[model samples]
Target: MEPIVDTVVIVAICVLGAALARRLGFIAPLVLLVAGLGLSFVPGLPEVHVEPELVLIGILPPLLYVAALQTNLVAFRRALRPILLLAVGLVMFTAFIVGFVVHALLPDVPLAACIAFGAVVAPPDAVSATAIARRIGLPRRVVVILEGESLLNDATALVMVRIAAGALGAAVSFWDIAGQVALKAGVGVLLGLAAAVAAAWLHKRITDPLLDDAVSLLTPFVVVIVAEELHSSSVVAVVVAGLYLGHRIPYLLSATSRLQMDAVWKLITFLLEGVVFLLVGLQLRDLVSHLEADVATTFRVTALVFLTLVAARFLWMYPATYLARLFPRIREREERPPPAVPAVIAWAGMRGVVTLAAALTLPRSANVPGDLFVFVAFAVIVLTLLIHGTTLPMLARGLGVREDTSAEDALAEASVQHAASRAARERLEAAADGAPESVVDRLRALTDSRSNNAWERLGSQAQETPSAAYGRLRREMITAERHVFKIARNEGRISEEVLNRAQRELDLEESQLNRSDD
Candidate 1:
């Protein structure tokens, strides 16, 4: 096999794929996957043989780190019960169901191979779900549940896959597997926490903004390598470290460091997502080449497996969510059970790269029936992407599970608060400059009333006595100033680079001012 993949090709694909994905919207990944498939058909595209070890080492760590950093821990905590059910219970249930179905359908295939198939396809890809979910107005709770599940489910699936793979080659006891799983998971978590704590301490010690940002960038790779070196799941470790670091990033890093780190990660994540999906598409050619079975038979088996997986999610989600509500301790303080959450849960089960990668990496021993597994995995991914991903927005619309307008409302309220805070700070400065006491008192009262109004709006509280009639006017003034700055850059009144820097500074100031009310 050609030496894995060239770095130049990888970089080119990601850069081009991202540009295209942005222009094409939801179909970007689909487009990239198709491109990869087409490229694979060419004579000199280089046979991109994927190693399972490479994926666990190269691809998983940074991806998991980015996912964890972006995840809203507060929102995730709110949906903890649902996440647990989906991530742990539901994934295991799906694996067992898929294993049974695969065994019955393909009796020639070993049970261990069947279980391996199930394990590969169990967890939904975080990148794919987040991309699609953002387009539709998924409620914050639903998004959190999906993200948290994706982040943690890989470890569960990997443990089972390892057990299945081992059993296929030799006799394996359940107790041994269980002990290994516990050891791997426990060690991974401990290592991740230790790494995060060390990084945090180092961050605190270093005050230079540039060095702090550079150190933060190094974290994901460190966490992943450390975990993998210790024979643990790097995916779990990266996530744990990411969550720990992200939660404390604001306190540990300077404002400039925080800004730089956020921008760098966003770019990295975008490229990783593009490359992975493109590779998924490219691997289809290799999978197809190994098949001796009839095309129709393969299609039939794929469809059956796809339907089973979809049906299993619906079966699991409704009862699990309902049961979760029965225990007060399990329910989040702000969480109210949504009547139509079942539909949301069912629709959110879109599989992507992890499944494809696992399938492509299957051992090609003659007894393993690796071709069938790869074909089935690819079939499920395509079907899920087209059937579930394409129709999710329509389903959400039908269920009346529209985007929570609350965040928008909160943002508007935040903008108003920001304007008021700016005004308050200006007045305070003037007071410090020896402004009249009476004028300062009047300005202070205006600030207080504006602040109170913003709080009421954010809390969704009923309107009390109206003290400030010009909150809207103040917001518009701030917005106009931003608009003018943009126009100045476009008209070449200021250099584009300078304009971007100023705009970011203004944006940060606005965010800070809004946060003051909280």
Candidate 2:
């Protein structure tokens, strides 16, 4: 039951659960959540409490950073109006609506307290949406909205939570609080940009890839703390920094650093994402153990809020996507909003840790029943994540939603690599006078191989594309070579070093082939 020991145990369960989730073909987060719930019932098990601060500071940054990195900033800007409508406008609308419903249903609770609960829980969870969205490859615009909203809505929700908490006994309208909140949010954004610039400057000077990756990990936390200390939006700070860093990362990172970062961030994302959902399920016990309201009333209120949650999103998305297109300027600049895109975005409105964490921040003096408040937040999170998260892929497939083809992406990647490889070949040609003919031939062979691979991807038909045919042959040859290498190693015909060197070459070729296919 020691703190570290308990922490280790939970992480082990999450790691094991993540492995099982992948192998069993379930969404990893959903599985981790189920596993966490199952573990809660083990006899004499130590209590697991997820702190709001830890979720916000320790967890939110890197996840948000990674999501920002994955997002295309220019594309995000093109969708700016709709993204704002959902991220900011819808967040506000949901809070007011949920607050009124809660107040009307539970009049004994102060209006501000009910409203505060609404504010805390209004924003769809960025983490939850990101985990699922990335896996399924929601349409590009949908990804932008889901991800952009996730990054931005936290600041909106938290600002409202603070204002609502401060106005508990007052008759201040939520709209009236918006002005002050906007001012504070602006400060947070400016500060976040400053932090990002500072971090970028520092990153540029560090030559070591390991140290650079470490800096990349730390940048989010440092910015979050800076923003929070100034009473600004830490989420905004992290998001802004992440977007900037991710956008400019190519220019700043060495090739080796870029490769290292890709692998490191993937592992970090997989595990952190696993733990976040695992923590979601782990909190179920605490939320339900002290049910302080009438069971039926609690269920009714929870059901009402859940319905409002889904309805608010649909209502907002339709108008935001289609109705706003009535403006000539807007229509001229943006794609005619697709109908199916909104369906995916609406279904993606699952609230997450920020909501729960905000729920825990409720002030006791506000006279709200803490158990009822937490329970409602907990129930909504579970239902939405379980329902929305699990059904998203099915919904996408049912709706015939598909991401850009891997072939399309492969072509783009190949084109960029081709350009770089050509530049390298030009440089080598410059050094041809000093270099021996054997070195020249070997280098040219490697360049030609890469160039052919790129050119094959461009013109190939379906799976029978040239790269595909080339990869199949190459893989078969590599397989044969691998077997021979193993046999030689086994029969003592080759030394370990020689066999390993040869095998490494085959492995690299196979991996390159797999990358082209993917």
Index of the highest-lDDT prediction:
2
Candidate 2: RMSD to truth: 3.2
Clashing pairs in 1: none
Q: What range of 10 consecutive residues in model 2 has the weakest lDDT sum?
A: 458-467
Worst 10 residues of 1 by lDDT: 464-473
lDDT (tens digit, per residue) of candidate 1 on 257-283:
777777887887777777777777777
**On residues 363-448, what C-alpha lDDT tens digit does candidate 2 reach at each position?**
87536887788889988888898999889989988887768666787688788888988898998999899778999999988887
Off by over 4 Å in 1: 1-10, 42-44, 169-180, 292-297, 328-339, 406-518
All models, RMSD in angstroms: 6.2, 3.2
Residue 208 miss distance in model 2 (angstroms): 1.4
Error (Å) of candidate 2 at residue 456 is: 2.2
Distance from true location, Cα of 483 in model 1, Å: 18
